[model samples]
Target: MMLIPTEKRLDADTPPEKRGQMRDGVRLLTYWSDSGRIVHGGFFQLAHQLEAGDVLVFNNSRTIPAELKTVDGIRVRLSREVEDGTWDGLILGESSKKLEFMHGLKALVTGPGTEPPLVRLVFSCSSSRLLRELYRQGDVIRYEHVARSWPLQDYQTVYASIPGSVEMPSAGRAFTWRMLAHLQKHGIRLAFVTLHAGLSYYGDDKWPNPALHPEAFSIEDEQAAIINDAKANGGRVIAVGTTVVRALETASDGNTIIPQAGVTSLYLSRTSKLTAVDGLLTGFHEQEASHIDLLQTFAGEEGVKAIYKEAVAKRYLWHEFGDMNLLMRQERS
Candidate 1:
């Protein structure tokens, strides 16, 4: 078993704090996957491993400019919500305190809301200038967790575009342009789809449950044609992130995939039958979160357990910037 560095092994002797630290954040587990075979390695070998006729698909949806700032002793954060408005919600403060000084409005933001519809904030503030100021600083934003301030880019993927994702789709971060070039040189092709990530609420301990978050998307016809052509020609179709998998699968009609544009609250797990994606490139998902179950479906239960056990034993890192896995398709029944 290869132990990922970020994990704390719990074989009936782990401590509570260590277990809390260990739960599902295992990283750095690498493996070679074909229809009927699996091999272990460090993650740095992927670029030199793949061959021609393999198509890698990526999600270009960007993370939103969101930050949790304090104003007048009130905790708040920015987010894009629904029904035509941006929500600058209040995260901390007495629920019945009726926030003082907010001129018939809330000036503090919490729980991240919609981008534009007249921001509803707490406290008495003149405008939403603070939120705009954070955006001006090269898209750097922060969020408070328990007591730590996690950097916004830390929650972002390298290919992030569209400034509306409160959180980030993390799988593509480890991929560099060099990796892309390596694949191209080896005759591997690439395609992209857009599935703007939802806010951090899905992972926040306050919610702790996979929020029924809705996602916005825009896919081009050329992208669909590229995917279809690859599949028809018997090339491998690799979904670069779980976000891409959800977007492509949701848009698929089992045998046919059509270009789609809209918002969907699609929740995926192992029981969810896949439609278009034949393989997946993804990061480690937190325990019990929806992504884990979804990945389990592709990895196969025993395969996933073995891979994770090996990764944890190998001392892999955890979280968004952690390592990745390649779950290949089962070519034969």
Candidate 2:
């Protein structure tokens, strides 16, 4: 895996608050795994690249204001919700004293979390109220790469409805309602699944552990039926993001998708067989990130490196507020 060049990184770049107007402003890089062909175009041209009957699976889980600034100057990013009003969160800015939050919320540091900056937080309120006050007091988490603070609405997709994910399912953020209508006019079908994305790649420099963190997801019967019919009819099932791939693959029974609603700890790698997805549309990820491994499972390692190198040379951006990549096979699997 190669590191993203400093200049090509999407440093401080964020799309405008209005998304539908910028459909033509975003960039897209498409790769055909079977034929080794690459096509670059504007994001608005996405509908023209695919034929009718393609099923694009999207993650509908919305982003939550998971970042809370404690009165003690601690920055707490709530990652995963747990039982008994507890949450797995990351605490930045060290404070030897117990932290106090807004809306009468108190944070009792239970223990170390799964990774660095992560810590277990036991809130003073009940489970339900704890969740409600989170929205009342917290702001959307920000990264060092971003220049300024943005609202939670800026992190949401047009189709986002369910509120659960700590972070945005950002690959789907490039989509607009108008673009979706265009896709529908071209006979491209859409399906929605819910995968509450957990902790994101912060400053961690190491590859993600194979033991994935549990993330909640839900696939309705209609969604499963749509995906199954698409596969059975020789239509491609294109996952809108890696989260959808994880949820769909986790709910797959052999080659067929099953309606399921639960938490998943599935990790896709070179060794894993992808039975549910035939194509992937996702944001440009760091080369050393775990997502590149999933990309290797879809495309080959060498091919991924080549395309990434091309993207870097062409000045395509990396990270959440970045360009998009569409990896599809020329032939059906």
All-Cα superposition RMSD per candidate: 7.4, 2.3
Judged by whole-model lDDT over C-alpha atoms, candidate 2 comes out at: 0.81
Best TM-score goes to which candidate?
2
Per-model tally of clashing residue pairs:
39, 0
Candidate 1 wrong stretches, greater than 4 Å: 1-37, 42-44, 78-80, 87-156, 200-211, 331-333
lDDT (tens digit, per residue) of candidate 2 on 1-333: 664565666542576444444733578999888877888999889986787888999999989888888987678888887766787787777775377987678978878766655677888887678768878988887666777787788888989999889889988988889889989999999999999888775455643453647788999999889989988987899999999989999999888999988888888886688888888998886565567888987778876877787787787866677788999866443
Q: What is the clash count of model 1?
A: 39
Model 2 lDDT-worst window of ten: 16-25
Model 2 clash pairs?
Answer: none
Error of 1 at 148 (Å): 6.9
Error of 1 at 287 (Å): 0.6
